[model samples]
Target: MAYHSFLVEPISCHAWNKDRTQIAICPNNH
Candidate 1:
């Protein structure tokens, strides 16, 4: 599978919206 990087920070977790049209991510910077 091919993945894309939209965030510059390392992501700890991610979630997609109900329609899967948007995303929410938690970065490991904190």
Candidate 2:
């Protein structure tokens, strides 16, 4: 799995499935 950061604030949280083919994410602000 991998992640990215923004210039202002944290954007979101994410995760990947066992095979690395699927992914899920949650917006940090919401």
Candidate 3:
């Protein structure tokens, strides 16, 4: 099996695509 990880800033909100192959996030800085 394989896995993945990400490093990001504090997020206020997030969403995923229908297929879940992509993602979107809104940082709290704004």
Candidate 2: residue pairs that collide: none
Candidate 2 residues lying further than 4 Å off, grouped into runs, are 1-12, 27-30
TM-score of each model, paired residue for residue: 0.44, 0.40, 0.41
Please, what are the lDDT tens digits per residue for candidate 3 over residues 1-30?
111432354334546569866667665534
Candidate 2 per-residue lDDT, tens place, 7-29, comes to 23343454557985665656554
Q: Pick the candidate with the highest TM-score.
A: 1
The C-alpha lDDT values of all candidates are: 0.56, 0.50, 0.49
Residue 16 CA error for candidate 2 (Å)? Answer: 0.6
- Model 3: ten consecutive residues of lowest lDDT: 1-10
Q: Tell me how far the alpha carbon of residue 29 in candidate 3 is from the true structure, in angstroms, after superposition.
A: 6.3
- In model 3, the runs with Cα more than 4 Å from the true position are 1-12
User: Which is superior by lDDT, 1 or 3?
Assistant: 1
Question: Best to worst by TM-score, what's the order?
Answer: 1, 3, 2
Error of 3 at 25 (Å): 0.5
